[model samples]
Target: MAVRGAGRVRSEVLSKKLYCASSTPPPHARHFADNQCQSMESFFTRFKNVLVLVAILLAQTIGLAVQVRRPVESGAPDSSKVTLIRYWAVSVVSPFERFFHGIGYTFRHGWSNYVDLRHTRQENHDLQDQIARLRLEQASFAEDAMQGHRLQAMLDFQQHYVSTTVAAQVIGTSGNDLSRVIYIDKGSKDGLKTDQAVITPDGIVGKIRDVFPHTSQVLLINDQTSGAGVLLATTRIRAILRGSTTGQILINNLTPDNRIKPGEQVLSSGGDQVYPRGLAVGTIESIKIDPDHQPYTLIQLRPAANLNQLEEVLVITGTQTTLSAQAQKDLAAGVTTAEAQAAAKQIADQQAAEAAARSAAQIVADRLPSIHEGEDEAKPGTAAPPATTPPVSVVPKPLPTIHSDRYSPGATPSASDLKPGAAEPPNEKDLN
Candidate 1:
């Protein structure tokens, strides 16, 4: 009976405990527990990303604080104590930066090479053009230098004829036979004027017909309308040298009585005032008489200037006299033109008479009798003189003697004191 009671009580106790444990909780407590679980899960779900960020920030803050504390104690960090943060940042970001930087550098370097090549090609082309231009300039400079030398020589030679002159280049020509003219690279701006006489070192070339600021047209002497006052050099006869329609130069206005021959030289007469006197005009080529003109002779001439191949020429701006101013002053003292001419004629006549006397003397000397061989054998210094009388008795008229200026007053001769058929007085050679 005791054991049964004990077992029953235990059973009852167990029932009670089981009943109590298994019984449903109060509504408020169950509600509270359910509410708390939901609240905790929602909180964790909603703030999980924020919680991770907070943790990372807290870790970085701690590391920064530690790094900052070390710098404060050491005043400043040395290379050995360099912060790990800097190295870590660089390690993480440097690869990306290096890759991007390498790409940028490659692009820039290639673009630079491309631009440099383009510039080099352009520069080479420009340099080639400049070289060509410089070569042409060098050629022109050489030509100008040569022309200057020739012009300088001409200036020196023509100092008396040319007072002053401007150098010019023959640039062009009138291309037609009707108008024989050339264009010079000089003009009014350079002091060139119309009708200015153009010449060369050889002879007169032409006259300026038109003038411009930078150029002038020169009418050549060979033109049909051109004429120059000329004189026959040998005969001293005045004539007009005109270019014919056929481009032939002829000396007209010469009377039939005027003696003109081929090869006679012609000279400028200065009558036209275009050319100074004594400039060579031409040489006569041929002569013919015009029956219709009754008295004028037609004389052809070869112009002195090489008109076909003219290069450099001179424009005679003015004339310079060969005679000095002092010479003219002295010449005007006692000498009249007529008296001077008369004196020249007397001197010419005296010279002619002396020439004739010399001729007679030579003839007499040639005809003299030869001495015997015995005379040739005589001693060189002791030979006997030859006979004065020759086979021919040639009479040589006495020549008028010119006295020096100091002896002129006392050396004058008179015809009344002259003897006829007089011979030279004997000298020591005649008596030998």
Candidate 2:
């Protein structure tokens, strides 16, 4: 009975321990379990994005492996064979990529078209300015070219005239309408003297009236005090060119018998000892009856040189004296004589050579065979006619001699002078 009581007590004790363990835990054990659950939740929160990235990487890696293992056929990919992973990836990423690309493209377009156009406009304006400057330079160059052409013409005229000239620039002018005078930047120091002719490439301008040390005064042909001896080029009528009180150039001492007409050219006659002969003076402008002198005709002339617009001129100191002195020197040195003799000798030699050639040609023509009538139609078997030879003692007839006094150079010979049987008369070229 005591053992049974003890067993009941132990069983009741074990039941109490089981109930405590199962239902209400100890404080230390419960605290450790709650801490483990909190730590697990914190770990998940800290690495949530990392875990998601790892999962995506794993999925892509599996897709790549599948793609690599699959056998690819040649040519276009079959839509049926395309994997869902690539399709989904392209679909999900395409919209954002396209959106960003469009934004970038629009931004670049605006920058290139709208923003950069400001600089382009400035460059265009600068280019226009440069073109304008170039056009101005071109105009300046054209003006220089025209000046060069004028200078060239003057140089050619100087060479043709073959006169000693001093180039002078027109510096000033006498401001009186009646006294048309100009001052030149040349003087006695430059070999300019009174009465020296002044001229341009176009025609004669005037003559020097007074000479200073470094400058000279010129009296233009239109001045009232100026006078020049002029002659009509076609009619050869001599007249005096004098300026009127009104600064009009008039031809005086022209009689009514003188048939002067407009447009006739006038040239210097060198009578006044101021201008050289053959220099262009003026042209006849009009012809009318003189009211003051009814017996004489009034003649108006237009000066050749542009007197009002004179810029450059040539002063002829002395062309005739210089040329005459040169000619005298050449003659004294026997240069002219030698040149004439040499030219004559050359001409004589050429004539002699031509005569010899003519003589030889005549002998050759006489030696050639001559055909008689019916020679072409003669049969081959028939004997040819015998050629008759003149007697060797029969001398040819002699030609008549021409008298030196009667033979005029370059005159054609008369038929009466040529004998019928004599050789042909000497040609005019042979006589020369």
Candidate 3:
């Protein structure tokens, strides 16, 4: 009876376990499960926005990283890797920019013409006065230049001659104050190259930083990375000119002991190999000792070219080496060929005049009355006798020589022989 009861209990337990495993849940448990599912769906729906924002930020960060990363060897940014976005943007927007530029140009052109016509008479008068002044200055400069040419010839100095240039219109600027760069309507197609000089009649503006197919960037002298070899126009002290973060240009590498004055002109030294020697750079504004960097004086400069307001510029496409041989031949005798010819003619004329003078003087001497050397002298109260025939040979009278015995070793000479009339020394005031 006990075994039969245990078998019945096991069968009942198996049946309950099977039924519980297969049976559906009660209403409260089903509700709880449904609520948890709804919460998960809602949480994921909110997280979608966060994920989108993260994706955008991540993309921007990557782009920025690409832009900032550069080849470690050279500080210069690899131009080949320069963002094509800039080129595409330029290509798309260039037509609009050019249209606006054209409009501005037309208005400016008309207004300028009207104003020019209005001021023509006054301008002409002013120009005449300016021409007069320039003429006077030019005459002085011509003389000075002639003298300089002579001196240069003597020193065998040569000058670099600009062989070719292409005119370019200033189209726009980089619009970044830190860069201080400008763009022109010229590029590689126009023979523009990186590091070529840009200038105007007034002074040097800058140099080509980057060249594109149809445009180029010119870095002004006030950019921090820009440097130039410069010379003090007055002192001729060579130094490196650099730009500072403060937007000021400075003549650097000068010792603290160096003397610098305000308003002293600065010029390109050509040591940097961009600008030709003697191009105008700027003028000194102030000088002070740098406390942070000892033994160096800080010199501030005001650029000669108005870099901020550039409208037109000249691109130096090429240069020719000045042949020393030509200059050597042309500058012979420190004068121009025409001047040398004139000088030669004048010297020849002077020689001819001197020869004529000597011949005339000889003829007059020959015409004078001849007197024999041995003829007796007439008495003071009697008439003088005239010479009839010339002597066979005329001998000059011998000069009297005083022997050393005339003055004994210890004896002092007479006053007539020792004393001479004192003449005033020549005045050097005129020469000075």
Candidate 4:
């Protein structure tokens, strides 16, 4: 009974305390509750964004795992197994990748093309320059070849003539066709003198008129005051070649009976002593009767040399004495006076023998009787004439003996001396 009574009492006291606490009690407890609620709201506001990101990542991871774990059905296409996530990702990124790739490829292609074009243009320009240089070189080589040919011709001419000559370059001209004069670089200092013959390899050009220290004036063949003695090649007709006021070469003192024809070559006759004999002057261009001078023919000539375009020339300084001097020296050294005298005597004896033999052969041929064809062929039925012996007075002449001191065993008879019914001429064999 006592324990029960105590318990009840204690219970009543506790119940009274609980009721008071529930009713709202201390100031410290109420302030603590408000602070806890404010702290919880501030924490939620700061962590909301982080929580949302974490939720999205978790969702992706779960979806990938589900796809990986999904079972494939038999006989299904491989496309069915591809997840929409992968398809969406490829579709969304492919356009941007392609756009950037196209831009890069276009830039690379354009840059390469531009570089190639630039290089090609530079190469083309270089090739053109090289071609131009080659053309210039070709022209230079051609000119050199022509000059060499001209020099070769001049050299040949010099060697053939064996005359002393001085080479000169045409420096100036009269500048008018009427004067027909030219100046050469050579002058008196170079052994040029007045009346010296001037010529080119092709033909005679002119003669030196005035000589200066460093230059000489040449009177061309076509000058009015110029004259040369010329002869026609075929007819050997001699005439005076003179120049007219109009720079034409004219042959004067030729009558119509001279038979001058176009295209006939004319040559120097050496009558004037200025030009060498047989030097080419010109070819006959035309022939016409002179109107001013009756009975005389006017003959025009085309010059052998290119007189209007003279470039180089040769001046004859002296006559052809080199060959003659060489011959004289050789003769003096190789033959004695006695040997020459002996040779001359032998030559005279041989000539006498030849002349005697010719006279005897002529006499024998004239004395021999010749029968006519008509007499030998008498009437067919008639008898032929009987042969008769010549009289003793018509005896054949004896051939003259050739007395050659130095007879050669290989001597042969001359074809010109052999005649019908004539005795053979004496040869060196017969003399020996």
Candidate 5:
């Protein structure tokens, strides 16, 4: 009785551990023990059920053999049994097929895999597009930063020059044909006006030829009829610079008193109130003079601005010149009627010269002497006397006559006087 009581206690303890997970009173332990006994009873019940199924199979062996033999012996009639077997087989197979099909393990597996690959590819492409856009944004930011630096440099330059300045970008340009002009964003609204000086980092670029409300047109230093007073940087000698239509700006009529030389630097002489003094014009490329006018030089200035390549400029304001219509709003700033008429006449004359050149070419090809014309067109350094002029006798002047500045006295040589065989003329250069 004691051994049986100990077994009962251990069983109660196990039941309490499984059901309550804590200490339990004796009365509840009795109920949990009852549940465990009932569970054991149900497990034995399932084992008996399996034994009963084996017994039934053993009893039906003869009947099942008969059922199978009927189908093997004849291919006819017993349709009910065949139908029953087919239904059973289909029921079992259909469940397995449906389950495996849900798993996608059979026919469309390759197509499903292909779809997955394409989806992944599209995602990768989207990611790449995002990266490319980010790169472009970075490049744009770098460009903006560089443009800001350039603008700051321009501002610093404005503070250095002698003017109340309006800095402008060279936004638009006419082609190399017709006339050389660039459009600036500053106009009459920004205190810019016609005849205002346009300068770049290097030196003079042009002048304000036209002014609108928000923009202005600049005539480049290369434009015909544009003139400035320039002096040699080496000698302080002064000369008038005039732009020719053929891209050559000549310093004309610098008299016997003022001498210009080759390879001398030239700058503004401060003679005019328009442009400030000491703005670079250009270095003298070459000087030509005639012995008949032995003291003056004919200088041709190449534009210092490189007008073909300027990108930014400062429009000088408040240096003693202002526009006529500063207070007139909504008005067109333009040249006078007389100036317009003169410009039209100049254009007409250019056209006429072009036509005459075409006619002259025709004449030269027909009957004129090409050889004689070539001699007449020779450069000053290499020119030879033409056979057309007679050999005239000349009396020699005295050696080294000095009391100069006496003959022409402040009168400069003209372009015609710059033919050839001239003495080294007085150079319009400053004393370095």
Candidate 6:
């Protein structure tokens, strides 16, 4: 399975790559290196001289406070000593002295405020980045929650149908971590056998190629050798969906004039041992008629499960045969839990179950509109989706009209390189 890497961080530094010779100097000069310091010192000294005079006068007040705090002799007791202490400590130039201190304090506070403002601006920039990251995370979590609903649909297959099913999340994928495999949470211990079908909420993914005690690797439907019987949902035209080496499907035997068109749904026809029926393969991208004169028309299928970005998938324990969700509900109507007395409770429970299912279905319908062939806008003037598009299902898109042997995870094996006039397996989308 491929290991996804975190996106690389972009450098915020505005580097213009200014290359210069040794003789070249910098654009900006140092502020304090000039005679500014001399001027400041001269100013400070002048201010200090004024402060010294103020200090000489104000010493009386400090002197009195000090005397009170610690009684002291006036050195040489003069007649003006007590009077000087009284006048200076109480009123002599006290207002001017306060004014001086206030100016000095204001300067200090102003410098500190500027520093604080710079720091706050940097912090705000960081906080903006944090908010953007948090929004991305919130969207991811919300998507995961919405995906929980889709999983509920996959899990619904486990419930309505009487098949032993185990759930698993796709922990990793391939390419960066290059391999044509998907790593799943389930393993041999969880009844995940080698070659067991792995799928998702939408439909079939692939089979377990290898299994460990707690983890298993899935051979994606995009695998060259992977093959499953598939039919168009709209046309019900049966065709063999096989994996391309390029990780798409070479839907062969589909004529250009056939009912299948781009965007038509594909599902497992369920003939071979690979996957069960009704497992959605993907939508048709284009219809083609190869001039090579093959028995059937050529079809290119996009996988239902996104094989490359295998973030999550489900592993089917046994074969699943579904008429439809609606069909199953209709079928269960006659089957009562008990006899006449318990009938009311059984009906209530069934109704409640149906209501819950409808509600769950409603959430999807509200978020996802049905897509028909080649229509751009979901409806006429529906708001464009938010900048962030949801993670596409592990599904791959259709291929162009080339020799359909494409979408392979790795190099095409020598045996799969069939030339013209050679009988090859009909569009091995996932030829098991």
Q: Which candidate achieves the best lDDT against the true structure?
A: 3
What stretches of model 2 exceed 4 Å from their correct place? 1-162, 321-432
lDDT tens string, model 3, 231-309? 9998889998887777789876888645678999999998988898889999999898877677788889999988778
lDDT per residue as tens, model 6, 215-281: 6657777766567778789887788776665777778766566455789998887766667666778
lDDT of 4: 0.72
Report the lDDT tens digits of candidate 2 across residue range 144-233. Answer: 544554686777633113358899977667667867877777777899877788999888898887666666778888887678889899
Instruction: Estimate, for each residue in 123-194, the C-alpha lDDT of model 4 and write its tens digit.
Output: 889999997676555544544544554686777643223368899877667667767878777777888888
The per-residue C-alpha lDDT of model 2 at residue 263 equals 96
TM agreement with the true structure for every prediction: 0.38, 0.39, 0.59, 0.39, 0.35, 0.37
lDDT of 1 by residue, 115-198 (tens): 657678788899999976765555445445445546867777442445666767666676678878776767778898777788
* Over 4 Å off, model 4: 1-162, 321-432
Displacement of the residue 211 alpha carbon in candidate 4, Å: 0.6
What lDDT does the true structure give each of the candidates? 0.68, 0.70, 0.73, 0.72, 0.63, 0.60
Best by TM-score: 3
Give the worst 10-residue stretch by lDDT in candidate 3. Answer: 70-79
Superposed model 3: Cα runs more than 4 Å off: 1-77, 83-85, 143-158, 323-432
Query: How do the candidates rank by lDDT, highest first?
Result: 3, 4, 2, 1, 5, 6
- Alpha-carbon error at 30 in model 3, in Å? 23
Better of 2 and 4 by lDDT: 4
lDDT of 5 by residue, 137-247 (tens): 544454454455467667763212353678886656655545666766566788887777788768887777666555666877666647777778988877777676776
* Model 5, C-alpha of 63: deviation from truth (Å): 99
- The residue pairs that clash in candidate 1, if any, are 385-432
